[model samples]
Target: MKRFAFALWLSAISLNAYADSANCHQKANTPESIAATMDQALQLKQQLNSQPDPVVILVRQGQDMSSRHLTWSHAGYAMRQPNGDWRVYHNLNTCGTAESALYIQGLYEFLADDLVNQSIAVLRPRSDIATALQTLLHSAIKLNLFHSPRYNLIAWPFSGPYQNSNGWLLEVFARANDAQVWSRNDARRWLQLQGYQPSIVSAGTFERLGAKLFTPNVFTDDQPTELLRKGNVGLNSGDSVIRFIAHYSRAIPGCEHQNLGESVCVYLSPGAKRREKIKNRPSRREKIKNRPFYANRAACKSAYLRRQVVPCGPSSRIIPISVRRSRAASAAAQSFALRASRRC
Candidate 1:
């Protein structure tokens, strides 16, 4: 009984943390909140002053509360300014639309999430890579071209169809490491070759269908083909980005495991080692192309239509087999819907 109670308590704490972290994007506009946020940013900036490198990757928890496994959700590049202050450059969906814009804001504004806990992770890259990233960020044309207007919540790191906040950072990181890379697809391929695995967000078939039909910002076209085949999507989270950096780059001293206010700081060494080539694998579509009813758009639509039914009324006489099945399916769907809402 004691163990069960302890487990229940742990679950409650986890839920609270997830809920708080997930709503970090709702900005607090009060003067007191703004002042406190600025003070926290100033403290963080001061901590970065001792680092030798001029550029670092800044990570923060996300505004998505539904994900239990995700601790960090957003990331951006921080570069030292002429006056020795660090400014963050990243894409943000500020207008609550499917559109996002690239902005270079001060550390406070960058960390202005209403639910932002006192925690930030900083990963510093090698001098050469930092120079490359700085150069790319300084170019107005490059920023404009790379800035995606549509924001896809589950935007695949490799696809060009749409992008989320983290997708933009992933592309910029890829381009910084390789000058020859010209497109988002190329960048994603490069990261794949480097063995970067994005975090997976799973949903039931009904949940996915509902999201597709209703959620404008949740799209599947930009998802990797393999994930789409499995009825899942890849999300580029800040934790995943940090993992990629740690895998490829050395961690610098003094930047690892230091406490800054309520936040812990980690610093990575500057340069990334070259990754060996991964063996070629068949694309998701290619592997599933011959399968019967492999979720082609028309087939999916037909299946959905076949399962949709209205209630039998006094004016109605006979209920078709399809309608009967659909009614039964509707009952099952209600149960699943309850579960899906709880998960979200």
Candidate 2:
């Protein structure tokens, strides 16, 4: 029996290695980047992804995500034991289980597909599950995704078979807006196309927004101030450029406003244009789109509400975003049970 068990264990190890190798195994290997601009791209990705349906993984990866990344968007599944040690399968890049990779599967699932047929990125949703899956397979071979617990409350509503369905699809795109991952202009434009006016976002409110996006797994919003340093977004609070974009986004948030004047509570993309419509003296268009990331509801609510109060007066209709968490999300919070079950 002992001998048989030993052989079985070894065989299991070997097979595991092979599977991981096949998944993350990049032949030419993925191109790597050290540029700060990567932050902007990641920020955009976060906004687009929003609170991930598979919440637990995202929070784990968000910590120190600023580190240089080796792409395995083409990489495949590598299941490293929860132990910190790394492993690889078959013959691929040496990838082990880390928080970044754990949650990054969600992000990889999106980028693995050719969102763009041409040089431009595809902002549209993909409907072909088979084609989409193929794109994912290709990407899995090239990227390394990880999870970091340092980032708090990564949303992961999609897990197991529940992922990839249309119902979850809406949740994914909605999350992008929730996180302010897309610049406000990009988010506004995208949402407008989908007839979705996502909640307003604020410059420095990721934590609060994180609450809404990730459920069944929210970590503490307790990253130290020093550790909360912004990535290389090349943006700062109150910049003249940001202010201008904010101005437009506020006006054309969904382009559904009944009144184009102060009665409108929507935001516009920087370079968005009006269809030669009458009224509104200033051409309601700009040539660029840039907006801040949303981290918290308070901050986001403030940004949009201030405009409403000024123009539409206090009676402006604001949509309700649950400040309270879902029961499942609250239950999954780390340490909540530990503290409760063993109260001193």
TM-score to true structure, per model: 0.64, 0.16
- Give the alpha-carbon lDDT of every model: 0.61, 0.25
Query: Which regions in candidate 1 have their CA more than 4 angstroms from the true location?
Result: 1-28, 64-67, 224-226, 255-344
lDDT of 2 by residue, 128-182 (tens): 3223322332343322111122211111212211111111222323333344322
lDDT (10s digit) by residue, model 1, range 1-344: 43243233223322222222223234448997777777778877877787766787888753433433666767888889989888888887633345667878888766665532446677777778888888988887876666677776667776667787777888888888888888777787888888898887665455556665544456666665776678566777766777777544445554445333212354222110111112245567665443233123333333334643333233222111232346667776545434432322
Candidate 1, TM-score vs. the true structure?
0.64
Relative to the unseen true structure, what is the C-alpha lDDT of residue 269 in candidate 1, on a scale of 0 to 100?
20
Inter-residue clash pairs, candidate 1: 22-63, 22-64, 125-270, 126-270, 126-271, 251-269, 252-268, 252-269, 255-267
